[model samples]
Target: MNRLYHESEDWVAQGSCRQYDPELFFPVSTTGPGLHDAELAKAICRGCAVRRECLQWALRAGEPHGVWGGTTPEDRRYMRRDLPLPAAS
Candidate 1:
């Protein structure tokens, strides 16, 4: 885990989707209502104060699932490629 994550646990409590089902953010499919659910998850993230930090954590952690910082996994993958992170300490 990174220092930011260790220091940012409180931010997760402030996330808009905290009360929603975790599965909603991690849909099993990308088709049909699943896509809509992802958008809904993003909507919640947009309202979160720690959206940027959440995204950074997800990218650095190489999260393979779920929505974070209003972005999908595919979004993070592209980001990781375009904005390579430094090796973990």
Candidate 2:
């Protein structure tokens, strides 16, 4: 069964995640201002209602790539360093 936090029947109302696609959201590293797309993804979490749940899902799923809760790989690494890591079993 799907684990972590799956969208409830009503979560689509937030209208944020609909634009998020793991493959497409990879961190575009360039010499620019602000967080990379990777970081911007994580930064968005600041105001996100499901930030905690999103972080949990990313850590538990062992998602090696993509952004979650507006956080990128490095951001997630720092945040989840002490969390129970779920192997990508």
Worst 10 residues of 2 by lDDT: 1-10
What is the lDDT of every predicted structure here?
A: 0.73, 0.54
Q: What overall lDDT, based on C-alpha atoms, would model 1 receive against the true structure? A: 0.73
C-alpha TM-score for every candidate:
0.75, 0.52
Per-residue alpha-carbon lDDT of candidate 1 for residues 1-89, written as tens digits (9 for 90 to 100): 12234455756666767678778888775456678888788788888888998888788889888888887887788787896633322
lDDT of 2 by residue, 1-89 (tens): 11224455343345355555543355554125423554555555566776666667677767766666555665567666766433321
